[model samples]
Target: MFDSKHVRVFDEVVRTGSFAAAARNLGYTQPAISQQMKALERSVGSSLFVRVGRGLKLTDAGEVLARHAADILGAISTAQQQMTAIVRLKSGRIRIRAFPSASATLIPSAVASIKNQYPGIRIELSEGEPPDSVEALRRGDCDITLAFTYNTATEQPASDDVFAVPLLDDPLIVLLPVGHPLARRRSVELAQLAEEQWIAGCVRCRSHFVQACAAAGFDPDIGFTTDDNLAVQSLVAAGVGISVMPSMVQSFIRHPKVVSRLVAPAASRTVAAYTLAGNQNVPVTQLMLEALREAAEEMRRGA
Candidate 1:
Protein backbone atom coordinates (compact mmCIF):
# COMPACT_ATOMS: atom_id res chain seq x y z
CA MET A 1 0.00 0.00 0.00
CA PHE A 2 1.09 3.57 -0.68
CA ASP A 3 2.31 5.19 2.52
CA SER A 4 0.87 8.58 3.42
CA LYS A 5 3.92 9.36 5.59
CA HIS A 6 6.24 8.95 2.62
CA VAL A 7 3.97 11.10 0.51
CA ARG A 8 4.10 13.79 3.15
CA VAL A 9 7.88 13.55 3.14
CA PHE A 10 7.91 14.04 -0.60
CA ASP A 11 5.62 17.04 -0.33
CA GLU A 12 7.81 18.57 2.34
CA VAL A 13 10.92 18.24 0.20
CA VAL A 14 9.13 20.00 -2.63
CA ARG A 15 7.59 22.65 -0.40
CA THR A 16 10.85 23.65 1.32
CA GLY A 17 13.15 23.16 -1.69
CA SER A 18 15.52 20.64 -0.15
CA PHE A 19 15.90 17.32 1.58
CA ALA A 20 17.68 19.05 4.48
CA ALA A 21 14.73 21.32 5.01
CA ALA A 22 12.33 18.40 4.71
CA ALA A 23 14.31 16.55 7.32
CA ARG A 24 14.26 19.57 9.59
CA ASN A 25 10.51 19.91 9.18
CA LEU A 26 9.77 16.23 9.57
CA GLY A 27 12.29 15.86 12.40
CA TYR A 28 14.12 13.04 10.68
CA THR A 29 17.72 12.50 9.84
CA GLN A 30 18.58 13.64 6.34
CA PRO A 31 19.74 10.16 5.40
CA ALA A 32 16.56 8.70 6.81
CA ILE A 33 14.46 11.03 4.66
CA SER A 34 16.59 10.10 1.65
CA GLN A 35 16.08 6.44 2.44
CA GLN A 36 12.33 6.97 2.67
CA MET A 37 12.38 8.64 -0.72
CA LYS A 38 14.42 5.77 -2.15
CA ALA A 39 11.96 3.26 -0.70
CA LEU A 40 9.04 5.24 -2.07
CA GLU A 41 10.63 5.28 -5.51
CA ARG A 42 11.27 1.54 -5.27
CA SER A 43 7.67 0.91 -4.28
CA VAL A 44 6.38 3.03 -7.12
CA GLY A 45 8.99 1.59 -9.51
CA SER A 46 9.88 5.07 -10.71
CA SER A 47 12.11 7.93 -9.70
CA LEU A 48 10.18 10.95 -8.42
CA PHE A 49 13.09 13.35 -8.21
CA VAL A 50 16.38 13.78 -9.99
CA ARG A 51 19.48 15.28 -8.47
CA VAL A 52 20.10 18.70 -9.94
CA GLY A 53 23.30 20.49 -8.95
CA ARG A 54 22.96 20.47 -5.16
CA GLY A 55 19.16 20.28 -5.15
CA LEU A 56 16.31 18.00 -6.17
CA LYS A 57 13.56 18.54 -8.69
CA LEU A 58 10.51 16.42 -9.41
CA THR A 59 10.67 14.40 -12.56
CA ASP A 60 7.62 14.18 -14.81
CA ALA A 61 6.36 11.23 -12.82
CA GLY A 62 7.33 12.98 -9.60
CA GLU A 63 5.34 16.02 -10.63
CA VAL A 64 2.28 13.86 -11.05
CA LEU A 65 2.89 12.30 -7.67
CA ALA A 66 3.42 15.69 -6.04
CA ARG A 67 0.17 17.00 -7.40
CA HIS A 68 -1.86 13.99 -6.37
CA ALA A 69 -0.17 13.77 -2.99
CA ALA A 70 -1.37 17.25 -2.14
CA ASP A 71 -4.91 16.39 -3.15
CA ILE A 72 -4.87 13.21 -1.14
CA LEU A 73 -3.55 15.03 1.92
CA GLY A 74 -6.20 17.68 1.57
CA ALA A 75 -8.88 15.03 1.33
CA ILE A 76 -7.59 13.32 4.46
CA SER A 77 -7.66 16.64 6.29
CA THR A 78 -11.18 17.32 5.13
CA ALA A 79 -12.26 13.95 6.45
CA GLN A 80 -10.85 14.75 9.90
CA GLN A 81 -12.49 18.15 9.77
CA GLN A 82 -15.88 16.63 8.99
CA MET A 83 -15.51 14.38 11.99
CA THR A 84 -14.46 17.32 14.17
CA ALA A 85 -17.31 19.48 12.96
CA ILE A 86 -19.78 16.81 14.02
CA VAL A 87 -18.42 17.15 17.56
CA ARG A 88 -17.92 20.95 17.36
CA LEU A 89 -14.17 20.83 17.88
CA LYS A 90 -12.94 24.32 18.74
CA SER A 91 -9.22 24.32 18.04
CA GLY A 92 -6.42 23.25 15.69
CA ARG A 93 -3.19 24.45 14.14
CA ILE A 94 -3.05 26.68 11.07
CA ARG A 95 -0.11 26.53 8.68
CA ILE A 96 0.50 29.63 6.60
CA ARG A 97 2.84 30.65 3.81
CA ALA A 98 2.69 34.20 2.44
CA PHE A 99 4.41 37.15 0.90
CA PRO A 100 6.58 39.26 3.15
CA SER A 101 4.14 42.17 3.21
CA ALA A 102 1.14 40.14 4.34
CA SER A 103 3.11 37.97 6.76
CA ALA A 104 2.69 40.65 9.42
CA THR A 105 0.30 43.02 7.68
CA LEU A 106 -2.85 40.94 8.11
CA ILE A 107 -1.61 37.99 10.15
CA PRO A 108 -0.36 39.43 13.45
CA SER A 109 -3.35 41.25 14.91
CA ALA A 110 -5.67 38.46 13.89
CA VAL A 111 -3.33 35.84 15.28
CA ALA A 112 -3.28 37.69 18.59
CA SER A 113 -7.04 37.43 18.75
CA ILE A 114 -6.85 33.78 17.84
CA LYS A 115 -4.36 33.12 20.60
CA ASN A 116 -6.63 34.74 23.13
CA GLN A 117 -9.75 33.02 21.85
CA TYR A 118 -8.30 29.60 21.17
CA PRO A 119 -5.26 29.27 23.33
CA GLY A 120 -4.82 25.66 22.35
CA ILE A 121 -4.44 26.43 18.66
CA ARG A 122 -1.04 27.15 17.08
CA ILE A 123 0.21 28.93 14.00
CA GLU A 124 3.16 28.18 11.72
CA LEU A 125 4.37 30.88 9.38
CA SER A 126 6.50 30.70 6.23
CA GLU A 127 7.63 33.41 3.85
CA GLY A 128 7.25 33.04 0.10
CA GLU A 129 6.36 34.90 -3.05
CA PRO A 130 2.83 34.66 -4.52
CA PRO A 131 3.25 31.83 -7.01
CA ASP A 132 5.14 29.72 -4.52
CA SER A 133 2.61 30.47 -1.79
CA VAL A 134 -0.27 29.50 -4.04
CA GLU A 135 1.55 26.32 -4.97
CA ALA A 136 2.16 25.59 -1.30
CA LEU A 137 -1.55 25.89 -0.54
CA ARG A 138 -2.45 23.55 -3.38
CA ARG A 139 0.21 21.08 -2.26
CA GLY A 140 -1.20 21.10 1.30
CA ASP A 141 1.91 22.80 2.69
CA CYS A 142 -0.23 25.49 4.22
CA ASP A 143 -3.86 25.99 5.22
CA ILE A 144 -3.76 29.42 3.59
CA THR A 145 -1.33 31.75 1.90
CA LEU A 146 -1.58 35.52 1.59
CA ALA A 147 -0.25 36.77 -1.73
CA PHE A 148 -0.16 40.08 -3.59
CA THR A 149 0.96 41.54 -6.89
CA TYR A 150 -0.04 44.17 -9.42
CA ASN A 151 -3.45 43.46 -10.99
CA THR A 152 -3.41 39.84 -9.75
CA ALA A 153 -6.68 40.29 -7.92
CA THR A 154 -8.31 42.24 -10.77
CA GLU A 155 -6.99 39.83 -13.32
CA GLN A 156 -6.49 36.59 -11.54
CA PRO A 157 -3.64 34.69 -13.09
CA ALA A 158 -3.84 31.12 -14.30
CA SER A 159 -3.33 28.94 -11.23
CA ASP A 160 -3.85 25.24 -10.89
CA ASP A 161 -6.90 24.15 -8.90
CA VAL A 162 -6.99 26.61 -5.97
CA PHE A 163 -9.30 29.28 -4.53
CA ALA A 164 -8.52 32.86 -3.68
CA VAL A 165 -10.43 35.09 -1.32
CA PRO A 166 -10.05 38.70 -2.38
CA LEU A 167 -8.78 40.76 0.49
CA LEU A 168 -7.79 44.29 -0.56
CA ASP A 169 -6.61 46.47 -3.38
CA ASP A 170 -3.41 48.28 -2.49
CA PRO A 171 -1.84 51.22 -4.29
CA LEU A 172 1.70 51.25 -5.60
CA ILE A 173 3.97 54.17 -4.93
CA VAL A 174 7.24 55.47 -6.31
CA LEU A 175 10.24 55.93 -4.07
CA LEU A 176 12.49 58.90 -4.75
CA PRO A 177 15.58 60.24 -3.11
CA VAL A 178 14.73 63.44 -1.20
CA GLY A 179 17.11 65.38 -3.40
CA HIS A 180 15.65 64.00 -6.62
CA PRO A 181 14.55 66.65 -9.14
CA LEU A 182 10.97 65.32 -9.04
CA ALA A 183 10.84 64.94 -5.27
CA ARG A 184 8.94 68.18 -4.60
CA ARG A 185 6.35 67.58 -7.30
CA ARG A 186 2.79 67.06 -5.99
CA SER A 187 2.55 63.95 -8.11
CA VAL A 188 4.76 62.13 -10.57
CA GLU A 189 4.14 60.46 -13.88
CA LEU A 190 5.63 57.14 -14.90
CA ALA A 191 6.82 58.64 -18.21
CA GLN A 192 8.59 61.48 -16.46
CA LEU A 193 10.78 59.02 -14.55
CA ALA A 194 11.49 56.73 -17.49
CA GLU A 195 15.00 58.11 -17.88
CA GLU A 196 15.84 57.50 -14.23
CA GLN A 197 17.69 54.40 -13.09
CA TRP A 198 15.47 51.59 -11.85
CA ILE A 199 16.03 48.85 -9.31
CA ALA A 200 14.11 45.79 -10.48
CA GLY A 201 12.95 42.74 -8.59
CA CYS A 202 14.17 39.15 -8.99
CA VAL A 203 13.68 37.23 -12.19
CA ARG A 204 10.12 36.08 -13.04
CA CYS A 205 8.70 38.80 -10.74
CA ARG A 206 9.16 41.92 -12.80
CA SER A 207 5.48 42.30 -13.60
CA HIS A 208 5.13 45.60 -11.76
CA PHE A 209 8.48 46.79 -12.97
CA VAL A 210 7.50 46.04 -16.55
CA GLN A 211 4.03 47.63 -16.21
CA ALA A 212 5.37 50.79 -14.55
CA CYS A 213 8.03 51.25 -17.16
CA ALA A 214 5.71 50.28 -19.99
CA ALA A 215 3.23 52.96 -18.92
CA ALA A 216 6.07 55.45 -19.16
CA GLY A 217 6.39 54.38 -22.81
CA PHE A 218 10.03 53.57 -22.22
CA ASP A 219 11.70 50.70 -20.49
CA PRO A 220 13.62 51.82 -17.42
CA ASP A 221 17.41 51.69 -17.28
CA ILE A 222 17.39 48.93 -14.69
CA GLY A 223 20.74 49.02 -12.88
CA PHE A 224 20.26 46.60 -10.02
CA THR A 225 18.17 43.53 -9.27
CA THR A 226 17.56 41.67 -6.04
CA ASP A 227 14.81 39.81 -4.19
CA ASP A 228 15.48 41.65 -0.94
CA ASN A 229 13.05 44.57 -0.69
CA LEU A 230 14.98 46.19 2.13
CA ALA A 231 18.13 46.09 0.06
CA VAL A 232 16.29 47.65 -2.86
CA GLN A 233 14.87 50.41 -0.65
CA SER A 234 18.28 51.04 0.83
CA LEU A 235 19.74 51.37 -2.64
CA VAL A 236 17.00 53.85 -3.54
CA ALA A 237 17.61 55.88 -0.38
CA ALA A 238 21.28 56.04 -1.26
CA GLY A 239 20.27 57.49 -4.65
CA VAL A 240 21.65 54.47 -6.48
CA GLY A 241 18.33 54.44 -8.29
CA ILE A 242 14.56 54.93 -7.91
CA SER A 243 12.06 52.10 -7.59
CA VAL A 244 8.29 51.63 -7.87
CA MET A 245 6.92 49.61 -4.95
CA PRO A 246 3.64 48.95 -3.21
CA SER A 247 2.34 51.12 -0.35
CA MET A 248 3.35 48.41 2.08
CA VAL A 249 6.98 49.32 1.32
CA GLN A 250 6.27 52.61 3.06
CA SER A 251 6.09 50.77 6.38
CA PHE A 252 9.82 50.16 6.13
CA ILE A 253 10.66 53.78 5.44
CA ARG A 254 12.88 55.32 8.09
CA HIS A 255 15.31 57.16 5.88
CA PRO A 256 14.67 60.89 5.71
CA LYS A 257 16.57 60.75 2.44
CA VAL A 258 13.72 58.86 0.79
CA VAL A 259 10.28 60.18 -0.18
CA SER A 260 7.41 57.91 -1.25
CA ARG A 261 4.98 59.30 -3.82
CA LEU A 262 1.78 57.62 -4.94
CA VAL A 263 1.78 57.28 -8.68
CA ALA A 264 -0.84 59.73 -10.00
CA PRO A 265 -2.10 57.29 -12.61
CA ALA A 266 -3.36 55.17 -9.73
CA ALA A 267 -0.76 52.44 -10.09
CA SER A 268 -1.76 49.87 -7.51
CA ARG A 269 -1.58 46.18 -6.66
CA THR A 270 -4.04 43.46 -5.68
CA VAL A 271 -3.62 41.63 -2.39
CA ALA A 272 -5.48 38.46 -1.45
CA ALA A 273 -5.51 35.38 0.72
CA TYR A 274 -5.72 32.02 -1.01
CA THR A 275 -6.86 28.60 0.10
CA LEU A 276 -7.29 25.27 -1.55
CA ALA A 277 -10.71 24.94 -3.15
CA GLY A 278 -13.12 22.17 -2.04
CA ASN A 279 -11.38 21.92 1.32
CA GLN A 280 -12.71 22.33 4.82
CA ASN A 281 -12.67 25.81 6.32
CA VAL A 282 -10.15 26.77 8.95
CA PRO A 283 -11.23 29.16 11.73
CA VAL A 284 -7.73 30.62 11.95
CA THR A 285 -8.02 31.46 8.29
CA GLN A 286 -11.11 33.49 9.20
CA LEU A 287 -9.06 35.28 11.84
CA MET A 288 -6.46 36.10 9.20
CA LEU A 289 -9.20 37.59 7.03
CA GLU A 290 -10.24 39.87 9.86
CA ALA A 291 -6.64 40.88 10.42
CA LEU A 292 -6.21 41.69 6.74
CA ARG A 293 -9.33 43.84 6.82
CA GLU A 294 -7.80 45.80 9.68
CA ALA A 295 -4.54 46.20 7.79
CA ALA A 296 -6.37 47.40 4.69
CA GLU A 297 -8.35 49.87 6.78
CA GLU A 298 -5.17 51.17 8.33
CA MET A 299 -3.66 51.71 4.89
CA ARG A 300 -6.74 53.60 3.73
CA ARG A 301 -6.67 55.78 6.84
CA GLY A 302 -3.03 56.56 6.28
CA ALA A 303 -3.74 57.45 2.69
Candidate 2:
Protein backbone atom coordinates (compact mmCIF):
# COMPACT_ATOMS: atom_id res chain seq x y z
CA MET A 1 0.00 0.00 0.00
CA PHE A 2 1.19 3.53 -0.78
CA ASP A 3 1.28 6.23 1.88
CA SER A 4 -1.27 9.07 1.73
CA LYS A 5 1.50 11.60 2.46
CA HIS A 6 3.52 10.36 -0.51
CA VAL A 7 0.42 10.49 -2.71
CA ARG A 8 -0.27 14.06 -1.64
CA VAL A 9 3.28 15.06 -2.56
CA PHE A 10 2.95 13.34 -5.93
CA ASP A 11 -0.36 15.10 -6.62
CA GLU A 12 1.18 18.48 -5.84
CA VAL A 13 4.09 17.82 -8.17
CA VAL A 14 1.75 16.79 -10.98
CA ARG A 15 -0.39 19.85 -10.43
CA THR A 16 2.54 22.27 -10.45
CA GLY A 17 4.47 20.40 -13.18
CA SER A 18 7.75 20.91 -11.30
CA PHE A 19 9.34 19.48 -8.17
CA ALA A 20 10.44 22.91 -6.94
CA ALA A 21 6.92 24.37 -7.25
CA ALA A 22 5.43 21.29 -5.59
CA ALA A 23 7.88 21.66 -2.69
CA ARG A 24 6.73 25.25 -2.17
CA ASN A 25 3.08 24.18 -2.27
CA LEU A 26 3.57 21.24 0.09
CA GLY A 27 5.92 23.02 2.50
CA TYR A 28 8.76 20.64 1.71
CA THR A 29 12.27 21.02 0.35
CA GLN A 30 13.05 20.09 -3.29
CA PRO A 31 15.13 17.14 -2.05
CA ALA A 32 12.26 16.00 0.17
CA ILE A 33 9.77 16.15 -2.69
CA SER A 34 12.25 14.32 -4.96
CA GLN A 35 12.72 11.60 -2.35
CA GLN A 36 8.97 11.06 -1.85
CA MET A 37 8.37 10.92 -5.63
CA LYS A 38 11.13 8.36 -6.00
CA ALA A 39 9.67 6.30 -3.19
CA LEU A 40 6.23 6.49 -4.81
CA GLU A 41 7.70 5.40 -8.15
CA ARG A 42 9.48 2.53 -6.48
CA SER A 43 6.24 1.40 -4.82
CA VAL A 44 4.27 1.62 -8.08
CA GLY A 45 7.12 0.00 -10.08
CA SER A 46 6.93 2.70 -12.81
CA SER A 47 8.04 6.25 -13.54
CA LEU A 48 5.26 8.74 -12.98
CA PHE A 49 6.75 11.81 -14.66
CA VAL A 50 9.04 12.69 -17.53
CA ARG A 51 11.20 15.73 -18.28
CA VAL A 52 9.71 17.31 -21.41
CA GLY A 53 12.31 19.77 -22.70
CA ARG A 54 12.43 22.48 -20.00
CA GLY A 55 9.16 21.51 -18.32
CA LEU A 56 7.68 18.34 -16.80
CA LYS A 57 5.00 16.07 -18.24
CA LEU A 58 3.03 13.21 -16.77
CA THR A 59 3.74 9.72 -18.06
CA ASP A 60 0.96 7.21 -18.87
CA ALA A 61 1.30 5.84 -15.34
CA GLY A 62 1.35 9.36 -13.93
CA GLU A 63 -1.84 10.30 -15.81
CA VAL A 64 -3.69 7.32 -14.33
CA LEU A 65 -2.36 8.02 -10.86
CA ALA A 66 -3.17 11.73 -11.17
CA ARG A 67 -6.82 11.01 -12.01
CA HIS A 68 -7.14 8.64 -9.05
CA ALA A 69 -5.26 11.04 -6.81
CA ALA A 70 -7.77 13.81 -7.43
CA ASP A 71 -10.62 11.53 -6.41
CA ILE A 72 -8.75 10.35 -3.32
CA LEU A 73 -7.76 13.85 -2.29
CA GLY A 74 -11.28 15.19 -2.80
CA ALA A 75 -12.69 12.37 -0.70
CA ILE A 76 -10.15 13.12 2.00
CA SER A 77 -11.14 16.76 2.03
CA THR A 78 -14.83 15.88 2.32
CA ALA A 79 -14.07 13.50 5.19
CA GLN A 80 -12.05 16.20 6.96
CA GLN A 81 -14.89 18.68 6.58
CA GLN A 82 -17.33 16.13 7.96
CA MET A 83 -15.10 15.52 10.95
CA THR A 84 -14.74 19.23 11.57
CA ALA A 85 -18.50 19.69 11.50
CA ILE A 86 -18.96 16.83 13.94
CA VAL A 87 -16.39 18.24 16.36
CA ARG A 88 -17.80 21.75 16.12
CA LEU A 89 -21.30 20.45 16.91
CA LYS A 90 -23.96 22.88 15.67
CA SER A 91 -21.57 25.83 15.50
CA GLY A 92 -19.28 26.05 12.46
CA ARG A 93 -17.99 28.70 10.12
CA ILE A 94 -19.60 29.69 6.81
CA ARG A 95 -17.34 31.11 4.15
CA ILE A 96 -18.84 33.49 1.56
CA ARG A 97 -17.65 35.29 -1.55
CA ALA A 98 -19.65 38.18 -3.04
CA PHE A 99 -19.20 40.89 -5.65
CA PRO A 100 -18.72 44.47 -4.42
CA SER A 101 -22.27 45.74 -4.94
CA ALA A 102 -23.83 42.75 -3.22
CA SER A 103 -21.34 43.06 -0.36
CA ALA A 104 -22.45 46.66 0.10
CA THR A 105 -26.19 46.30 -0.40
CA LEU A 106 -27.27 42.76 0.53
CA ILE A 107 -24.60 41.11 2.67
CA PRO A 108 -24.63 43.53 5.64
CA SER A 109 -28.19 42.82 6.73
CA ALA A 110 -27.79 39.09 6.06
CA VAL A 111 -24.59 38.89 8.10
CA ALA A 112 -26.16 40.89 10.94
CA SER A 113 -29.15 38.54 11.07
CA ILE A 114 -26.90 35.48 11.22
CA LYS A 115 -24.82 37.02 13.98
CA ASN A 116 -27.92 37.78 15.98
CA GLN A 117 -29.46 34.31 15.67
CA TYR A 118 -26.32 32.14 15.73
CA PRO A 119 -23.70 34.02 17.66
CA GLY A 120 -21.56 30.90 17.99
CA ILE A 121 -21.31 30.43 14.22
CA ARG A 122 -18.57 32.43 12.50
CA ILE A 123 -18.72 34.05 9.07
CA GLU A 124 -15.79 34.64 6.72
CA LEU A 125 -16.49 36.91 3.74
CA SER A 126 -14.45 37.71 0.63
CA GLU A 127 -15.09 39.93 -2.41
CA GLY A 128 -14.60 38.54 -5.90
CA GLU A 129 -16.17 38.55 -9.34
CA PRO A 130 -18.56 35.81 -10.44
CA PRO A 131 -15.99 33.51 -12.05
CA ASP A 132 -13.48 33.80 -9.21
CA SER A 133 -16.20 33.37 -6.59
CA VAL A 134 -17.42 30.13 -8.19
CA GLU A 135 -13.85 28.89 -8.56
CA ALA A 136 -13.26 29.52 -4.88
CA LEU A 137 -16.34 27.44 -4.06
CA ARG A 138 -15.00 24.57 -6.22
CA ARG A 139 -11.63 24.78 -4.44
CA GLY A 140 -13.45 24.44 -1.11
CA ASP A 141 -12.40 27.94 -0.16
CA CYS A 142 -15.97 29.16 0.36
CA ASP A 143 -19.41 27.68 0.99
CA ILE A 144 -21.63 30.34 -0.58
CA THR A 145 -21.32 33.08 -3.22
CA LEU A 146 -23.32 36.07 -4.38
CA ALA A 147 -22.89 36.45 -8.13
CA PHE A 148 -24.56 38.44 -10.91
CA THR A 149 -25.16 37.92 -14.62
CA TYR A 150 -26.32 40.54 -17.07
CA ASN A 151 -29.11 39.41 -19.36
CA THR A 152 -26.79 39.05 -22.29
CA ALA A 153 -24.85 36.38 -24.13
CA THR A 154 -21.49 37.65 -22.90
CA GLU A 155 -22.33 36.98 -19.25
CA GLN A 156 -22.63 33.36 -18.21
CA PRO A 157 -21.52 31.22 -15.29
CA ALA A 158 -18.24 29.44 -16.02
CA SER A 159 -19.23 26.28 -14.20
CA ASP A 160 -22.31 24.12 -14.60
CA ASP A 161 -22.15 23.00 -10.98
CA VAL A 162 -23.20 26.41 -9.70
CA PHE A 163 -26.67 26.07 -8.18
CA ALA A 164 -28.14 29.48 -7.53
CA VAL A 165 -31.11 31.01 -5.74
CA PRO A 166 -32.33 34.08 -7.60
CA LEU A 167 -32.00 36.96 -5.15
CA LEU A 168 -33.16 39.99 -7.11
CA ASP A 169 -33.37 41.58 -10.52
CA ASP A 170 -31.12 44.64 -10.52
CA PRO A 171 -32.19 46.96 -13.32
CA LEU A 172 -29.92 49.56 -14.84
CA ILE A 173 -31.09 53.05 -13.91
CA VAL A 174 -30.15 56.33 -15.54
CA LEU A 175 -28.30 58.79 -13.27
CA LEU A 176 -28.75 62.37 -14.36
CA PRO A 177 -27.76 65.73 -12.87
CA VAL A 178 -30.53 67.42 -10.87
CA GLY A 179 -31.18 70.11 -13.49
CA HIS A 180 -30.91 67.80 -16.53
CA PRO A 181 -34.10 67.82 -18.65
CA LEU A 182 -34.56 64.03 -18.16
CA ALA A 183 -34.54 64.57 -14.37
CA ARG A 184 -38.13 65.75 -14.59
CA ARG A 185 -39.26 62.48 -16.08
CA ARG A 186 -40.01 59.38 -13.94
CA SER A 187 -38.61 57.07 -16.64
CA VAL A 188 -36.20 57.88 -19.44
CA GLU A 189 -36.02 56.29 -22.88
CA LEU A 190 -32.61 55.07 -24.00
CA ALA A 191 -33.06 56.70 -27.42
CA GLN A 192 -33.68 60.10 -25.78
CA LEU A 193 -30.06 60.17 -24.48
CA ALA A 194 -28.44 58.79 -27.62
CA GLU A 195 -26.35 61.96 -28.07
CA GLU A 196 -25.56 62.63 -24.39
CA GLN A 197 -22.07 62.31 -22.91
CA TRP A 198 -21.83 59.07 -20.96
CA ILE A 199 -19.83 57.92 -17.94
CA ALA A 200 -19.80 54.11 -18.07
CA GLY A 201 -18.98 51.86 -15.12
CA CYS A 202 -17.94 48.18 -14.88
CA VAL A 203 -17.23 45.83 -17.79
CA ARG A 204 -20.76 44.45 -17.86
CA CYS A 205 -22.22 47.90 -17.41
CA ARG A 206 -20.27 49.08 -20.41
CA SER A 207 -21.53 46.13 -22.42
CA HIS A 208 -25.06 46.95 -21.39
CA PHE A 209 -24.49 50.51 -22.47
CA VAL A 210 -23.44 49.35 -25.93
CA GLN A 211 -26.35 46.94 -26.26
CA ALA A 212 -28.95 49.35 -24.96
CA CYS A 213 -27.66 52.19 -27.13
CA ALA A 214 -27.44 50.00 -30.22
CA ALA A 215 -31.05 48.92 -29.66
CA ALA A 216 -31.98 52.55 -29.41
CA GLY A 217 -30.47 52.97 -32.94
CA PHE A 218 -27.30 54.87 -32.03
CA ASP A 219 -23.92 54.19 -30.41
CA PRO A 220 -23.11 55.74 -27.03
CA ASP A 221 -20.58 58.55 -26.80
CA ILE A 222 -18.52 57.23 -23.85
CA GLY A 223 -16.87 60.35 -22.48
CA PHE A 224 -15.61 58.81 -19.26
CA THR A 225 -15.25 55.36 -17.70
CA THR A 226 -14.85 53.91 -14.19
CA ASP A 227 -15.58 50.72 -12.27
CA ASP A 228 -16.52 52.43 -9.03
CA ASN A 229 -20.24 53.02 -8.42
CA LEU A 230 -19.62 55.95 -6.06
CA ALA A 231 -17.36 57.66 -8.60
CA VAL A 232 -20.01 57.15 -11.29
CA GLN A 233 -22.62 58.92 -9.14
CA SER A 234 -20.19 61.65 -8.13
CA LEU A 235 -19.20 62.37 -11.73
CA VAL A 236 -22.85 62.52 -12.79
CA ALA A 237 -23.67 64.85 -9.90
CA ALA A 238 -20.88 67.18 -11.05
CA GLY A 239 -22.73 67.62 -14.39
CA VAL A 240 -19.85 65.93 -16.13
CA GLY A 241 -21.89 63.21 -17.90
CA ILE A 242 -24.86 60.88 -17.53
CA SER A 243 -24.48 57.20 -16.50
CA VAL A 244 -26.33 53.89 -16.32
CA MET A 245 -25.77 51.94 -13.11
CA PRO A 246 -27.28 48.95 -11.37
CA SER A 247 -30.09 49.53 -8.88
CA MET A 248 -28.12 47.83 -6.09
CA VAL A 249 -25.69 50.76 -6.14
CA GLN A 250 -28.53 53.03 -4.99
CA SER A 251 -27.65 52.03 -1.42
CA PHE A 252 -24.24 53.70 -1.83
CA ILE A 253 -25.60 56.93 -3.34
CA ARG A 254 -25.26 59.83 -0.91
CA HIS A 255 -25.16 62.69 -3.43
CA PRO A 256 -28.34 64.79 -3.48
CA LYS A 257 -27.33 66.58 -6.68
CA VAL A 258 -28.22 63.60 -8.87
CA VAL A 259 -31.55 62.07 -9.86
CA SER A 260 -32.02 58.39 -10.77
CA ARG A 261 -34.63 57.47 -13.34
CA LEU A 262 -35.71 53.96 -14.31
CA VAL A 263 -34.99 53.19 -17.93
CA ALA A 264 -37.76 51.99 -20.24
CA PRO A 265 -37.30 48.84 -22.37
CA ALA A 266 -35.49 47.73 -19.24
CA ALA A 267 -32.22 45.81 -19.28
CA SER A 268 -31.22 44.19 -16.03
CA ARG A 269 -28.86 41.79 -14.31
CA THR A 270 -30.03 38.83 -12.25
CA VAL A 271 -28.48 38.73 -8.79
CA ALA A 272 -28.25 35.22 -7.43
CA ALA A 273 -26.98 33.67 -4.21
CA TYR A 274 -25.15 30.52 -5.13
CA THR A 275 -23.15 27.55 -3.90
CA LEU A 276 -21.50 24.50 -5.43
CA ALA A 277 -24.15 21.86 -5.97
CA GLY A 278 -22.03 19.30 -4.14
CA ASN A 279 -21.52 21.52 -1.11
CA GLN A 280 -22.50 19.69 2.05
CA ASN A 281 -25.34 21.26 4.00
CA VAL A 282 -24.35 22.23 7.51
CA PRO A 283 -26.33 24.09 10.13
CA VAL A 284 -24.33 27.28 9.65
CA THR A 285 -24.58 27.24 5.86
CA GLN A 286 -28.34 26.62 6.03
CA LEU A 287 -28.88 29.48 8.46
CA MET A 288 -26.72 31.81 6.39
CA LEU A 289 -28.69 30.99 3.24
CA GLU A 290 -31.94 31.71 5.04
CA ALA A 291 -30.63 35.01 6.31
CA LEU A 292 -29.50 36.04 2.83
CA ARG A 293 -32.90 35.19 1.38
CA GLU A 294 -34.65 37.22 4.08
CA ALA A 295 -32.43 40.22 3.50
CA ALA A 296 -32.91 40.02 -0.25
CA GLU A 297 -36.68 40.01 0.23
CA GLU A 298 -36.52 43.12 2.38
CA MET A 299 -34.45 44.91 -0.23
CA ARG A 300 -36.89 43.89 -2.94
CA ARG A 301 -39.81 45.22 -0.90
CA GLY A 302 -38.04 48.53 -0.37
CA ALA A 303 -37.17 48.77 -4.05
| lDDT tens readout by residue for model 2, 24-88 | 98789999999999999999899998888978888999899999998888888888987776445
Q: Please write out the lDDT profile of model 1 over residues 1-303, one tens digit for every residue.
A: 578789889999989989999999889999999999998898888999988899888899899998898998898889888658533426656787878767656677667766776676678889988677777787789888888756645546436566667767777778898999989987788888878888877554466668657766997888888767778878988989988777775674446678888787886777877777644355556665566567667666766
Best by TM-score: 2
Q: In order, what is each prediction's RMSD in angstroms?
A: 18.5, 14.8
Q: Worst lDDT window (10 residues) for model 1? A: 83-92
Query: Which portions of model 2 miss their true places by more than 4 Å?
Result: 1-90, 158-160
